[model samples]
Structures are given as C-alpha cells and as structure tokens.
Target: MAPHLADWRGRYVGSALAVVKPADTRQVAAVVRACAAANVPMVPQGGNTGLCGGATPLPDGRSVVINLSRMNRIRSVDAANNALIAEAGCTLAAVQQAADAENRLFPLSLASEGSCLVGGNLSTNAGGVQVLRYGNMRDLVLGVEVVLPDGRIWDGLRALRKDNTGYDLKQLFIGAEGTLGIVTAAVLKLFPRPRARATAWLAVPHPAVAVELLGFLRARCGERVTAFEIVGRAALELVLRHIPGARSPLAGDHGWCVLLELTDTLDAQALDAMLESAIAAALDTGLVTDTAIAASVAQAAALWALRENISEAQKIEGVSIKHDISVPVSRIPEFLERAHAELTAMWPGVRIVAFGHIGDGNLHYNLSKPDALDNAAFVSRTAEVNRVVHDLVASLQGSISAEHGLGQLKRDENARYKSDLELELMRAVKSAFDPRGLMNPGKVL
Candidate 1:
C-alpha cells in the first residue's frame, strides 16, 4: 500500500482500497473482469516511477491498484528478427540486460532505467538522451498485448516490421497512460550493438550554438551522433555541489555545455578519430569554447553522470516548479531567452535550471526558489510559473507535456492549450475504448 500510493516525485500521495499483483496476463484479465463486474474503478501501475501522477490512484480511496511488479519476465528474444518480448512488469534494466545478453542494444535510456518498468515507459512514450538517434519508446515498440477494461485480452504482439492492414491499434495503447487498456506485454525493436563509442563534453557559447553544433555533427557524422544534450550552468553547478566525485570536464565555467556521443559498428580508432576531427572543426568555428573527450569508458560515464544527476541534485536542493516542454529545435535559444526574461521579471532572482535532450527540442525547464524563499512559498507559485512557461511553449508551436504525460498534474492545464476539436476527439477515443471509464481515471483526459 505504501509503495503503490506514492509517485516517484513524492508530489502525489494517493489512496487505494487494495493493491493487487497479477502473475500473468490471464490473471490481469481476471482482476479487470472482477473490478468491472463490481463497478470498481481500476488504476494500472507499473514501476510507479512516473514524475506525473499517472500511476498513482486518486486520494478518494475508491479505486483498486493493479501493481504489475510480479509479472516481470522476458518472454522471448529473437536476435535474428531484432525483437524481444517482455512482460509489462519487467524493469527497464532487465529488458536492457536481455538485449545486451544477445549482443544487441535497446536504446531507450534514462536516469530511472534501473527501476522504471517497460509498461510505464511505453505508456508515457518516454523520450531520453538517445532519443536523438533511436527515437522514443513509441518508435521502439512494434506491438503490444493489452487487457481492456471489459477483461478482454487483445494479443497484438507481432514482431513484423510492416503491416498496413488497417488502423494501428497498438499506437492507441502505447501512450494512452493505461486509460485505454493495461499493457501486459510488448514486442520491442532492437538494434545491433555498437562496437566503438566516443563521448565528449563541449562548452558552447549558448543554446543557439548547441543547436548549430548538433546540425554540424549530424550533417557530417550522420547517425553516428547518438546523443546530443545541453546543460545549463546552474544545472552543472548543482550537480557539482551535491554529487560526490563530480568534476567539471572543462577548465572554466561556461554558460552552456553540450554532451555529445558518437557510436559505430566499425573500428574504435576510426570512431575516435572521426569524433576528434568534428570537435576540432567546431572549435575552429568558435561554436565550442572548451572541450573534453573521454579517453576511457569510465571517464565517459563520469561525464554522463553530470547530466544524469541534475534531477537528483535539484531534489536535494529544494522544492521547485518543474515543466517538461518542447519547441522547434531551431527556436530553442529564443525560447530559453524569452522564458528566462519573463520568469525573472515575474519573480526576481528566480533560479532557472534548464537542461535536457536539446537535439530533440525537449527541455526540462525547472525553477528553483530564491535563497530567501521557503519550500511552501515556492511550491505555491507553481500555477503562476506554469502559465509563464507553458504559454511560451504554446506560442512556439510546442507541447506542454513533452515526455511526461498529462496526468493529474497537468490534466487541466493541457485543456487550455488543446483545440476543442482535438479535445473532443481524444475524449471520444477514451470513451470508445473504455465506455464505462473503468480504466485508470483522472489521467490524460
């Protein structure tokens, strides 16, 4: 009960009459059938690592939580077909290990991969650092097995790469946040493991240069540019202050930095030389001020640790307003400049910690409290801060909820940005899927 009632962020604490663990898809269907017969709503949860309150049940204690942790299993792995079937409850780390066992790569990575479940990742359509190359979770999945609200199991788990017979039903359940159905298993796409890799930390002049540098690398290195992430000065400072053994890759403090990685199936020496040449060219163009290329795998991991520890460091710092938003890649610099100017104007000395998958245009724009402010006061201003940030995102033709889904946290806020026709269509789809609305309620509506 304790574990199922709270979300990963600790911002949402819910209540449930009971937490039930189903061993397999048939058991899950049985539970769903029983709940539907009894007119009790169901909340389907995976690892419960969602930043939004998507997996947490409501506080009314009227719903039954279906925890999928027990259904952990890797059903099958077909290396020849480049696909693997995993149960909904399997931790992302488990799935990665399975892929690695076959000498393959499952490129959906994030800070919470160790504990986050595959079902939750598919439901949220998670985007991570490697999204610049491998795409999001939605793209990585070829098929899904879902248990609908009426207890019927839709076994659409096919590993085929192409099937244009009709409407893509799997897409509906992929990012539906369990509002449509409970995903029990999935056929995930995999790729050949990279034989060679190169990582570098570059200090950029600003966000604009980071964007230009991304284009520069992509044009020359092509798909070898696996990831390109941007880190703000404030974000790096927080990591240095809080995380042990964290060290700056560059000599001097830079306003913005970029973490780029190149991987190839070719020789390691050739990959390193290619990456070095690209960096040298960027340096000559003044796009990069200072740089640090990892000579060893350990050093590369350490450099990645700096980007990965931003969320944790901020948690240790204090309460703050957080937004997962995205805009056009070209307009990233403009968005940052406008957002900073507006947020500071509203709250003087407001600490803005902006960092994320800049190659894909997604930014984890967070606001830390001023030194003089307290926790409660800073949190209380969440609504005001969201308006300032979300409005800018909308103006730039961006999404309010980028990687994180619109759970209870941003449900209403999302309505303001969506067109009436789009909202009506979404509701129609929800109603069609779960007419009685017995599936996870108060989520993505």
Candidate 2:
C-alpha cells in the first residue's frame, strides 16, 4: 500500500500489494481492467474513515487497493435541477458547502463529514442527522458512475428526477458496500436550504417518555423535525467527564435526554418560537421532564458538541465493544429495557453506553468495563455480547447493522443472523455483477 492501510479508528490494519491512486474516471477504469486481467481482487478506498472496516483490504496482500483520493472533483452543479455531480473522493463537507453556495442543501451530515468521502457515504448508504428529513445517501442520489468488476464503466450519471426507463442499477451499488463495483462519481439531489432552524435539548424520565415526546413533537412540527437524537444519562456523563468544556443542559441527571432540531423555510426567530412552544406543551403533558432551548447560535452549537463528542470521549476512556443497530421506533423502549436488563444481569458492573438516532430507530449501543481491565479480556467477550444483543434484535425483526454496513467487522456475524435464502439472493446478485468476486472482496458478502 502507500505504507499502510488503516481504518479511521485504527482497529483494523490491512496489507495490500500496492496502493494505486487514480486521478480520473478513465484512470479508475484502467486500474480496474488491469486488476481484472490478473484475476486480482481490488479494494476501493476513499477517505478511509469508515467504522466498519469496509475500506480496509484483506491481510493476505493479494489485492490491489484503488485509492480514489486523487479523483476529488466537483464536475458540475445544476441549480435549476437541484442536483450536483461530484467525484467520489470529495469530502462530504465540501459537497455541502458547494451546495450552500448555490442556495441549495445537501443535508447528509455526520460527525466525520470533514474527512469522510461522498463515495464512501454512497457505498454504505450512510444515514446521518438529517435522515429523518432528507433520507439517506441512497435516497438523495439520482445516478452513479461505477467501474464494474470486469473493468467496464456504467455511466448512469444522469441528473434526472424521474428516469423510469429500465431497472435502476444505481440502487444496487448505493448500499452494496462496494462488493460489486467501485463507484467513481454520483449525481446527487439537493434541496433548498432551510431558512430557519430551532434546536432544543430535553430531559426525559425514560426511553418510553422520549419516544412519546418524539411522536408528540412530530405531530406538531411535521416534516420540519430535522433531527431527533437520544442520549442516555451515562452517555452524557461520559461526555462531560472526558470532553473538556462539555456541560449538561439540564441541572440534574435524567434517565434520558433528547437533542432535537426543527428546520423549515421560515423566519429563524419564528421557527425558534414554534419549537419552544412545542417543548412547553410537551412538558405540560408530562412527555418532557425538563428542557433547554438554544438562545444563541454559539449556545446551540455547544449543546450539539456534547452529543457529537460522545464517541470520541468514550474512545479516550478505553477500548470498548460497540454495535450499530436499529429496531422499530415503537419498540425502542422495549429493546433498551430488555437489552440493558439482560446485559447487566450477565455481566454485573458492566458499563453500557446506549445512545444514537432514536428518531431513525438506530442506536450506537456500546459496552466497556466498569473498572480497568485488559483490553484483550474485554474484547474477548465481544461474541458473547453480540449473541445476546443481536439475538434480541433478530427476535424484534430488527437489523444487526443499522447505518454501518457489514464490512469485515460483522461479515461472519451477519451470516449467522441473515437467513440462507436471503444470503443466497445477495450472493446471486453479487455474482450477476461480479462473477470473479474481485470488487471489494471479503466485504458485505
């Protein structure tokens, strides 16, 4: 490789035969053709910040890594059609800013936006803060230009809102985690930038109460509810303890907390007032126990900083086992109650850090030792912990992986949860696109 191939978290280190940086789509096609001729597997890499080890190559050193960082380019911006065509290696933040410059919005957002690539986002079908309002990358995409496993280029980069000409091949690669092909560019949809945004932090008594308040707020706010994130008391505590200058919005510890935002095409102050009134009504109805509405832009950012910094704070604490899972929104309370009870009972004194996009039914459920322990010892029980949590997710008809795809991290675990019939179909599709199994081998499949 280019010295090394490491994941964003540095948990996965892989070796490749060589890392080839392609400067354009034609160069990407050439790289793919060469790899295909040699019957060699090709691992497509973007910004290399994926949490699921999706971008990391196998350790065998048999694959040629196709690094797309050099292909970063904004091909065109069609403000009239509300779409933008960009190369895969462009940072997500850059894309958002470019859209904003045109008075448009590309609302897919995550904490790693500053470093993550739009192509990687498309490959994982990334869901982020605005998933509730703008949907995931899959829904935001209009077309994709991909280098198929065999080196042929499928240029479906049409920026049309409606194209019912034939089967939508773009959808296959959107969330396939790069198993079938390497996405080089994409035509993505955009929206008019929200004229106003109102954010509030609320303290709730329980997960059940948080779920209720979400429904209540949505009933009043409708699609304007841009984001609804839930933070457990323990999660918030981790932030305050490890993240400097982090302050709790509420005075006392609550069982659960929500960081909510409402955005609309209206006056900023009016939207803020509307959000405040909604929270007040929820409090009157006992759906919310306490609340803190942002009074200034800086104050609002500080509140978000706390929620966004939880992952980093936990990392500072120590190594921990983590899961990205999702269940029905209505079943979130039951999932949390049962998961916590069973995990705590099994591993007494285990610290469970549960928090994430409750509005989208996804949770970043994590576990760490209550006191200092060998990292190896803590990691050894990952399978046992996964058995309990994923089994429960299976029973609830939920997903073992929510936003993060089944990269090397959960490849085998996914085999356990997904039915043979389902996996067979997935394999069949993979074969249809890549009979040689060369594109991003050992991932998703």
Candidate 3:
C-alpha cells in the first residue's frame, strides 16, 4: 500500500484504503462491482511509473488502489494482422519482446519501458523518441478493452484498420488517465522490423540550426529519419559530470547538439553510406559544427544513452523545476528564446537544461537552482516560474503538458490555459462516461 501511494518522482505521496491485485479480468470485474456497490472509489494503476501521480491514490484513504501487476500476460499475437493483444499489467518491454519474437516491431519506446506498463502508456497517450516517425501510443493502438465503472466489460478490441463507426468510444479512455474507466487490455499495431540503423551525435550551431538539419534530412532521406533529439550544452555537461563513463562524442563543445537516428529495412552498408553522405553535405553547408557517426552497435547505444540519461542525471544533480512542453516545430526556437530570456530575468543564473524530441516540437525544459539559492527557496518559487513559462506556451499556441498527461500535477495549471468552453466540453465528456465519478477521482479533469 505504501509503495502504491507514491509517484515515481516522489513529488506526491498519498494513501489508500487497500491495495487490490486482481489475477484476471473476471476478478477485476468482481472487485470493481464490490467497490461500486459500496460506493468506494477506485484508482486503477499499472506499473506505478507515471511521473504525473496519475496512478497514486488520494490521501483520504477512501479509494482502493487496484494494482494490475498480477494480470501480466501476452494474450495473443497475429503476425499476419501485424497486431498483438497485451494485458494491462504487461510490461512495455514484454510487449516489445513479443513483437520481436514475431519478427515485428512495437515502436512505443521510452526510458521507462523497462518498468512502465502498456496500459499506462495507452492511458497517457505516451510519446517517445520514435514519435517523430511512429506517432504516439494513441496512433499505435488499434483497439482497447476497458472495464466500465459499473464493472461491465466493453469488448471493443477490434483490429480493423478501417472502422468508420459512428463514435470511437475507445478514444475517450485512451488519454483520460483513468478518469473515464479502467483500460484492461489493448490491441497494439506493429510494423516491419528495421534491419539497419544509423545513429549520430552531432554538434549544431543552435536550436534553429537543429530544426534546419531536421528539415534537410527529412527532405533527402524521407521517413528513414526516425528520431531527431536536441540536447543543450548545459544538459550534456550535467550528464557527463554525473553519469559514470559518459563521454563527449564530439571533439569540441558547441551551443547545441542533436542525437539523430535513421532506420530502414535496406542493407546496412547502403544505409550507412547514405547517412555518411548526408552528414558530409551538412558539414559542407556549415549546418553542423562537428559530428560522430556510431562505428558499432555499442557506440550507437552509447550515444542514445546520453540522451536517455538526462532525467536521471538531473535528479542526481538537485531539485529543480521541470516542464514538458511543445509548440509548433517552426516556433520552437522562438519559444526557447523567449522562455530563456524571461526565466533568466526572473531568476538570474538559473541553469536551463532543455532537451527532447525536437523533431516533434517537444522539449523537456528544466531549470536548475542557482548556486547561491537553497533548495527550499528555489522550490518555493514553482508557481511563479510556472506562470512565466505556461503563459508563454499559451501565447505561442503551445501545450504545457505535451507528452505527459495532466494528472494532479498540471490539472489546475492546464485549466488556466484552456478556454471556458473547452473545459466545459471536457467536463461534459467526463460526466458522460463516469456519471458517478467513481473512476480515479481527482485526476485529469
């Protein structure tokens, strides 16, 4: 119960009446029915790896935390259909392995895939590095099987690619963060496994140049440009300083760097040659300051490790303000320029650790406390910092909670940016699916 009552970030702590682990869907339905009869709320949780505290129960101890760890199973895989059914508690890594066993690819990857569950991914509509080419969890899922608040199973797990139904009910629960219902299982779409991959660590003049590089690579290489991530100089330094064995991939420091990857089913030699040609042209055009192409699989993984370890490295550094934000790809540079200027004006010498999937316009913008300030003093100014950043996001038609769902952390902040009509519509949907409001109360809406 104690473990289930806290979030992965340890930013939120909660309590629950009891932690219930159902072995199967039938048992889950029974537990849900019992809770419904007693009017006891429920918080459906999977893996408990969410950063937003969406799966944590409330401190009131009025709800039961339904932990889905016991329901871990890969129900079936249809290779011909390029789809697989996974139970709610199945680890994301397990699902990926299942796809690999069938010689297929499940491209919904994240740093937490080793521990995060597929249900949580679906519920949050998670986005990852591959989202630039593969889209998010919502795009990867073909259908969902959810359990209504009243303990009724809605078996909507159809694997059809073309379904012109009157209303797509599964979508209502996809990104609802369990406010609507409990997603018990999902039908995940798969793709052909790539035979060759080319990874590079590149130094860029600035974020704008990184954006230009992305466009240039896309124009020439097309969909092979699977991932394009940007890391600020400050971010890379933190990783190199904190993470063991982390080394700089380039010869010299630059203002910004990008971790780009290209994947294809073509021959490995041809793919590597194409990547080399692209990097050579970029160098000739002065788009890249320096670059390092991965000579082996181990080197490619090392380059990816630098980008993936940013969050962990920051955690080891100290407490700081964090934001997952996004704007139009064209406006990213403008957003960064304005945000840095405003944040620095408010709190001088605040270390900005900005990095993320620049190809998809999302950035994990974080701020480290200045050396002169204490942790408590810097953390106390969270609201002021949020106002400065979120307001700018609104001005630029951006989202404050881009990939991360608006759990308890950003629910109120999100309301400030959304219009009255938009909030009203969202509330209407909530009421429609959960009239009694017994499904994960105090989350999302």
Candidate 4:
C-alpha cells in the first residue's frame, strides 16, 4: 500500500482506502463495478513511474487504487501483422523483449522502460527518445481494451492498420490520464529490427546549430535519423559529478552536446560510413564543433547512458523546479534564450539544466536550487517559476506538459492555459465517459 501510494520522484504522496491487484481484465472490471456501486472513487495505476503523479491515489484516503502489476502478460504476438497484444501490467521492457524474440522491434525506448508499464504509457500517451522516428504511444497503439467506468468491458482490440470505423473511441482514453476510464490492455505496433546503428556525441556552438545539424543529417541520411537529443553543459556536468564512472565522451569543455543516433537496415559498415560522412560535412561547415562517434555497440550504449542517466543524477543532486515543455522545433533556441533571461532576472543563482529531444521540440528545463537557498524556500517559489516558464510556453504555442500527463500537478495550470471552449469540450467528454465522476477524480479536468 505504501509503495503504491507514492510517485517515483517522491513529489507526490497519497493514501488509498485499499489497493487492489486484479489478475485479468475481468477482475479489473469487477473492481470497477464494486467501486462504482458504492459511489467511491477509483484510481487506476500501473508501474507508478509517472513523473506527473498520474497513477498515485488521492490523499483523501477514500479511493480504491486498482494496481495492475499482477496482470502482467503478453497475451499474443502477430508477427505477420506487426502487432502484439499486451496486458496493461506488462513492463515496457518485457514487451520490447517480446518483440525482439520475434525478430521485430517495438520502438518506444524510454529511460524508465524497465519499470514503466505499457498501460501507463498509453494512459499518458508517452513520448520517448525515438518519437522523432517512431512517434509516440498514440501513434504506436492500434487498439485498446478498456474497462469503462460502469464496470463493463469495452473490447476494441482490433489490430487493423486502417479502420475507417466511425469514432476512434480508444483515443478518448489515451492521454486522458485515467479520468475517463481504465485502459486494461493495448495492441501495440511493431517494426522491422534495424541491423545497424551509429551513435555519436557531438559538441555544438549553440542550440540553433544543433538544430541545423539535425536538418543536415536528415538530408544526408533521410529517415535513418532516429534520435537527436541536446544536453546543456550544466546537465552533462551533473551527470558526470553525480554518476560514478560517467566520463565525458569528448575531451574539450562544451556548452552544448548532442546525443545523436542513426539506425538503418543497411549493413554495419555502410551505416557507419553514412554517419561519418554526414558528420564530416557538418564539421567542414562549422555546424559541429567536435564529435565523438561511437566505434562499437558497447561504445554507443555508453554514450546513451550519459543521456539516460541525467534524471537519476539530478534526483541525487536535490529538488528542483522541473518543467517538461515543448516549443516548435525552430523556436527552441529563442525559447531557451528567453526562458533563461526571464528566470535569471526573477531569481539570481538559479541553475538551469535544460535538455531533451530537440528534434521533437521537447525540453526538460529544470531550475535547480541555488547553493545558498533552502529547499523549502526554493520549493515555495514553484508557482512563480511555473508562471515564468509556462507563460513562455504559451507564447510560443508550446505545451507545458509534453510527455508527462497532467495529473494533480498541472490540472489547474491546464485550465488556466486552455480556452474555455476547449476545457468545456474536455469536461463534456469526461462526463460522457465517467458521468458519476468515479474515475480518478481531480485529474485532467
């Protein structure tokens, strides 16, 4: 119960009347029915690895939390159709491995794949490192099997590639953060496994240059460009300082670094050659300052480790005002410049650790506490900090919650930013699904 009551980052702690683990979809439907009959609230949780506290029960201690870990099962795999049916409780890593066993690829690669559940991924419509190439969970999922708020099962698990059927209703639950209904299982897309991958650590003069380099690589390599991540100097320094044996990939000091990887069905040598040729051209044009191209699979993984370990390293450092924001890909440089200027003007000595999937415009811009400030004092400024950051996001036509769904953290902020009509339509949809309002109350509406 205690483990299910809290979020991974320890930012949210809640209590539940009781935590229930169902063995299958039927049991989950039963639990929903009982809770609905009693007029008690229900919270559907998966791996509990969500950063936005979407899965944690409410603090009122009256809700019943339906934990889905025990329902972990890979129901079936259709290699011919390039799809797999996985229960909501299956770990993302397990699903990936299942695809690999069939010599297929499930391209949702997240830092928390080992712990995060597929159901949670669908609930939040998660975007990961490969979104630039593979898209997000919404694009990957072909169908879903949900337990409606009234305890009835809605089996919409048709693995058709194109279903012109009226009303794609599964979308209602995706990214709704469990406010509408509980997603019990999903039909996920798969792809042909790439035979070769080339990873690199590149130093850039600025974010704009990194953006330009991404375009240059895409022009030369086409769709082989898989991931392009930007890490600022402060973020890389944190990883190196906090993570043991996390050596700098490149020797010289760098203000900005890009973790770029290209994957293709081409042979290893050909793929490696393609990456090197592109990097060489960028270096000649001054788009790239310096580069460390990974020589082997292990080397590439080591490079990726530096990017993946940043959040864990930051958690070790201390609490911070963290924001998952996105702007247009072209406006990221402007956003970065303006955000830094405004934030520093508001509070001096704030350490801005800004980095993320620049190819997709999402940046995890975090403001760490100054060495002299206490945690309580810094955390108290969350609202002001959010205003400064979210206002900039709105101005740029960007989202405040990019990959992380809005649970208790950003529900009010969402209302403030969304138009009245948009909010009304959202609530109308919510009421249509969970009219009794028993499904994850006080979230995403």
Candidate 5:
C-alpha cells in the first residue's frame, strides 16, 4: 500500500483501506463489485509513474486501491492488422518489445517506458518524443476493455481499421484518468519497424528558429521527421551536473538545443542523405548554428540521454514547481519570450528549466528553486506563478495540461482555464458513465 498510495514524484501521498492486485479482467471486475456493493470508493492505479496525483488515492483512507500489476499479459498480436492486445499492467517497454518481436514499432517512447504501464499511458493520453509523427496514446489505441464503475465489464476490443458504428465509446476511457472506468486491456496500433534512423543534436538561435527548421525539414523530408524536441540551456546544465556521464552533444553554451530524429521503414542510406541535405541547407540559411549527427546507435542513445534524464536530474537537484504546458506551434516562440520576461520580472533569479516535444507544441516548463530560497517558500508562490503562466497560455489559446491529464496537480487550474459550459458538458459525460463516482474518485472530473 505504501507504494500504491503515492505518486512517482512524491508530490502526492495518500492512504487506502487496502491495496488489491487483480490477476485478470474477471478478478478486477470481482474486486470492483465488492467495493461497489459496500459503496466504497475505488482508486484504479497502474505503474504509479504518474506525475499528477490521478493514481494516488485520497488521504481519507476510506477507498480501496485496485493495483493492476499482476495482470501483465500481451493477449494477442495481429501482425497483419498492425495491432496487438495487451493487458493494462504490461509495462510500456514490454509492449514496445513485444511489438518489436513482431517486426513492428510501438512509437510511444518515454523516459519511464521501462516502468510505466500501458494502461496509465492510455489514461493520460501520453505524448512522447515521436508524437509529431506517430500521434499520442489516444491515436495509437484502437479499442479498450474497461471495467465500469459498477463492476460491469465493457469489452470493446476491436482490431478493425474502420469502426463507424455509433459512438466511439472507447475514447471516453482513454484519457479519462480512470475516473469513468478502469482500462484493463487495449488494442494498440503499431507501425512498420523503421529500417533507417537519423538522430541529431542542433544548436538553434531560438525556439522560433527551431520551429522554422521543423517546417523546412518537413517540406524536404516529409513524414520522416519523427521527433523534434527542445532543450533549454538550464535544463541541459542540470542534466550535466546531476546525471552521470551526461555531456553536451554540441560545443559551447547553447541557448536552446534541438534533438531531431528522422525514421523511415525502407532504406537507411536514403534517409541519412535526406537528413544530411536538410541539415546542410538549414546551416547555410543560419537556421541551425551547430550540429552533431549520431554516427552509431550507441551515439544516438547517448544524445537522447541528455534530453531524457532532465526530470531525474531536476529531482536530484531539489524540489521545483513543474508545469506540462502546450501552445500552438506558431506561438511557441512568443510564449517562451513572454513567459521568461514575465516570470523573471516577478521573481528575480528564478532558475527556469524548460524542455519537451516542441514539434507537437508541448513543453515541460519547470522552475527550480533559487539557491537563496527554501523549497517551502518557493512552493508557496506556486499559485501566483501559475496565474501568470496559465493566464498567458489562455490568451494564446494554449493548454495548461497538454499530455499529462488533469490529475489533482492541475484539477483547479483546468477548471480555471476551461469555460463553464465546457466543464458542464464534461461533467455530464462523467455523470453518464460514472454516476456513482466510485471509480478513481477525486480525479479529472
């Protein structure tokens, strides 16, 4: 119960009456039945790697935690259909490996892939590095088997490419954060394994230049532009200081760096040539300042490590106020410039560590505590800081929580940003599916 009642970042700690692991869908249904019969609230948790408190039970200790670790299984693989069915407890890495064994690719690659479960990924509608090309968890999932709040199982697992029959009911549970129903298993979409891969780290003049480079690459390389990420100077320095063996991929202090990857299924040489040509042209146009193209698989992984270890590195440094935000791709430069100007004006010497999948318009904008200030004092100003940031996001027509769902972390912020009618419509949907509100209480809705 200790691990099940807390989240990955330790920002949220809770208590549960009991932590029960159900081995399969039937067992999960049974547990939910007993809980529902007693009118006890249920908290459905998977992997516990959530940054938000969506998986964390309430501190009241009145709820039963349904931990889905024991239900790990890859039910089936339809290689011809480019889909597979995996139980909720399967780690994202395990799903990726299973897909690789079938000569297919599961493109949801996250830093926590080895530990985070597929069910949690679906719950959050996770966006990762490759979302620019592959889309997020919502797009990758074809169907799901969910255990409703009343313990009735909804088995909607269909591996069809076209399912125009009525409502797409599966979507209700995908990013609902288990407030509506617990996703037990899913029909995950897969793609052909890439035979060619090119990864490069580039020093860009600014976020706008990086955006321009993405458009340039897309025009020349087309859909081969698999991932495009931005890493701030502050984020890179944190990784260098905290993560062992992490080093800068380029020389000199870069204001911002882009980790760009291009993948193709057919020919390696052709993909590499396309990337090289694009880089050469961008360099001539001053769109890129410096570049380090990975010459080997090992080099590519090393380059990726600098971007991946940012969260862990920040964790090692100390507590920080973190934000997972997204604006329009065109407004990214404006957001950055305006955010920096405003935040710095409010709190001088505040260290900002920002990075994420800028290709898809999501950025993990976080602020580390100033060395002169304590954690509590810095955290105390969260609301004020958030007001400044979120208001700016609202003005730009951006999202406060892009990939991460509206867990307890941003529940109030979500309410503040979303319109009254929009929230009312969402609540109507929540009531339709989970009138009892026994499934993962105090989350999302």
Candidate 6:
C-alpha cells in the first residue's frame, strides 16, 4: 500500500490489504500460496488500464492486489523459430519493439499499447485494428506459463506452430481474465514484418457499401487487405472536433468513411500503385464515393490516428454507454439499420456513435445524450440500453461480448446468452483447474 490503492477511470476504487510486487514467477507462486493459506482472495492487476473493471478489485478489503508491473522481462527471442517469449508484465509496445529488433512482427496492438501489459492483453484476448489480419490475442499466442490458484506452476510454454496435443490448456487461461490463474509469461507467434504498406481513406455511401467494399478488396488483394475499418459520420465528427488539429482525411463527410490498409511482403511502390488502381476501380463501380491515399508514412499514420483516437475523443466528450458487440459480416448492415431505428425511436436526442473493425463485423456502438444528464441518471439507464442492444445482437446470432471478455461487466449477461450445458462445462473446467476458487473471483464465470 505504499504507492496507493488503484483507481482507474474513476470507476473502480478498491483498497488492498497490501499491494505485492513480485519480481518473478517463483515470487508470484509464493505470494499465491501465502494468500491461499490465509484463505484471502488475490486480485491480479496489470497496467490498470482495462475498461471492463477486470483489473480493479472490490472495495471490501478482503484481498491483496498482486501487481505484475515489476516482472517485465524479455525471456527469449527465437528469430529462427519465429517466436518470442516475454514475461507477463512487459508492456505491449516493448514486446512489439523486441519483435521488430528480430525483424519480425507482433501484431496485437491497441491505443493503450504504450501502457497495457502483455498479460492483460492476453487475459482479455484483445482485438484491435489489426485483428482482421492477425486475429485476436488468443491466436497470436502460441503458449503460456501460468501459476494456478493453488500455487502450482503449469509450464506449457512451447513455441511450436503446429502442436495438436490434447486439450490446448493455454486457451483456458488466455481469455480467462485471470479467473483461472495468473499468466506469468507467454510464448507468442511472430510474423515476417510486412516490407511495405498502402493505406487509403475511402468514403462509402452506406454501411452496406462498406461491407461490399470489404468483400471486394479481400477478393482482389486477398490477405493483403491487412485492415478495413469503418467510421460513421458522427464518430468522425467527434474526433475532428475534440481531438486537436485532427483534419478530415477526405474532403467532405459522406454517410460513412472506411480506412483501408494494405500491407505486403513485396515492393512498396507496386503495393501503392496496386491500391491506387483498386480504389479507382472501386470508385468507377460506385463502391466508393471518394478517396484519399496517404502519400507518405506520416500521412498513413495520421489517417490511422483518426480511427484510433475515436475512443479517446468519446471519453473526453463524456461518460457514454458503450457496447462491444459483433455480428456476422453478412448481417452487419441489417444489425446496424435495425439497432439504429429501434433505439432512435425509443430514445430521442440520443447520439449514437457507431464504428469499429467492420472487417471483423465488430462495432463499438456507444450512446450519449445531446442534452447532458447527471451521471447517476445516465448509469441507471444502462440496463435498459443493454437489453435493447444485446437483444438485437442475440437476434442476429452475434456475440454480446466480442473481443472484450465478460469481466464482471457482462458476466451475468453472458450467462444468460450461453446455454446451460455450455455453462456447466465451463464450470466443470474451472473446478477441475481451480477447485478452491482462490484465483481471481467474480470474473468470467
């Protein structure tokens, strides 16, 4: 308790009996054993940047917070094997830099990469702008070394690409949100760094056009379409207005805008020309309304900054009700249309900010009122808003919690969406791995 109790986003504030800083896995295991012997709950925290309140503990003061920041280390970098082993506490940016040093790439990236820990990224199975190409954190991870709740170390850290062994145990803890165990370290997959990239900001007539354009680009460029993101007009306006010096990528705001990124292991000049011709073709066919291609690396990053700064802009605007729901790519247009119509009819003057990795059919649908209200009033309506949005997600056969795990925020709601049989099997696995339930409790079943 020397530094202070953790308070993140001004939402979760918990007092820890003692905040333990362990230097390594052995120290973590010993701390876990001591807590288990005393029958005290242990809340594992990393970076304290999670939006779902997973890293924050309860206010009851019945637990000791085990912060993983001190365990930062790059254990190994096997360039030939195409894998890198890093401790759980290493910052994600640091991991990416390590991979870069070896002429490889670690593609798990988010706006919080500078501060978020590798352990937290794995725990949540984070999917950022690049998920459409690299998949989520779960896919990027090859193996993990976890310390069980009972202080037993399960070392499954293997860097092999093709390991079809019985029951991939690494998965259980990867997205478990630390409910099952403490992820002490990870063996992550690395890819040959894409030698060249081409980026463009395109204007689409509607969400349907965005979806069709995504399909079009994929068929033409195939795997080279590394990132395809959609930004609604309102969402874009927020960034331009709130974020300083944020200029519009395109001339005027159409119905929607899409940021397309193409990366290849081939020549940069060829890729740029190819993307330019592709965009021109798309425009001729009316798939695209307008377009702006980045002329330099700085311009490309600026285009991406417009998309990445959406969340930060929203936060600055005010506390809004946010939902990270995803539907199938084919049904994205329908879902957006129906959700917007229904919600607008019910709640007038509600500003809806819809945007995300449309390539993955995941939209960060958030709500804020034009007329400001008190925090309590806004929060009190959360259940109602959730019912409307989540019910539609269910109707579309989509997931309520997409990349973000159900860390206390959506845990109960997820139970409702999942089948009884599925919940039973999950509980069985939890019991088998952590019988005493001394691990991170009140999270993800």
Best by lDDT: 1
Cα lDDT of model 6 by residue, 1-445, tens digit: 6333553456557776888989999999999999999998888888877877787777788888898999999999999999999999999999999999999999988888999899999898899889999999989999999999989899989998888868888988888888889999999999999999999999999999899999898988889998999999989988998999899977765779999999989899999988988898999999999999999999999998999999899888888888999999999999999989988897766788999989998999998885556544755789898999999999999999887777778889898889999999999988988787767777788
RMSD of each: 0.9, 1.2, 1.0, 0.9, 0.9, 1.5
TM-scores for every candidate against the unseen true structure = 0.99, 0.98, 0.99, 0.99, 0.99, 0.97
Candidate 3 lDDT over residue span 338-418, tens digit each: 999998887877889999999999999998774735656877899999999999988999999888898899988889999
Q: What lDDT is reached at residue 290 by model 3?
A: 94
List model 4 lDDT by residue over 1-445, tens digit each: 8999999999899998999999999999999999999999999999999998888887899899999999899999999999999999999999999999998999999999999999899999999999999998999999999999999999999998899969999998899988988999999999999999999999999999988998999999999999999999999999999998899999889999999999988999999999999999999999998999999888998899999999999899889889999899999999999999998887777899998999999999998675735655877889999999999999999999999999888999999899999999998998899898999998887
Task: Supply every candidate's count of residue pairs whose N, Cα or C atoms clash at under 3 angstroms.
Answer: 0, 0, 0, 0, 0, 0
lDDT of 1 by residue, 149-199 (tens): 999999999999999999999999987899999999999999999999999
Error of 6 at 299 (Å): 0.7
Local distance difference test, each candidate: 0.93, 0.90, 0.91, 0.93, 0.92, 0.88
Model 4 lowest lDDT segment of ten: 368-377
lDDT of 3 at 205: 92
Poorest 10 consecutive residues of model 2 by lDDT? 370-379
Report the lDDT tens digits of candidate 2 across residue range 293-339.
98888988998998899999988988889999999999999999999
Model 3 has an lDDT value of 0.91
- Report how far residue 345 has shifted in candidate 3, in Å: 1.0
- Candidate 6 TM-score, true structure as reference: 0.97
Residue pairs clashing, model 3? none
lDDT score, candidate 1 = 0.93
**Candidate 4 lDDT for residue 284:** 99
Any runs in candidate 6 off by more than 4 Å, and if so which?
Answer: 1-7, 374-378
lDDT of 5 at 397: 97
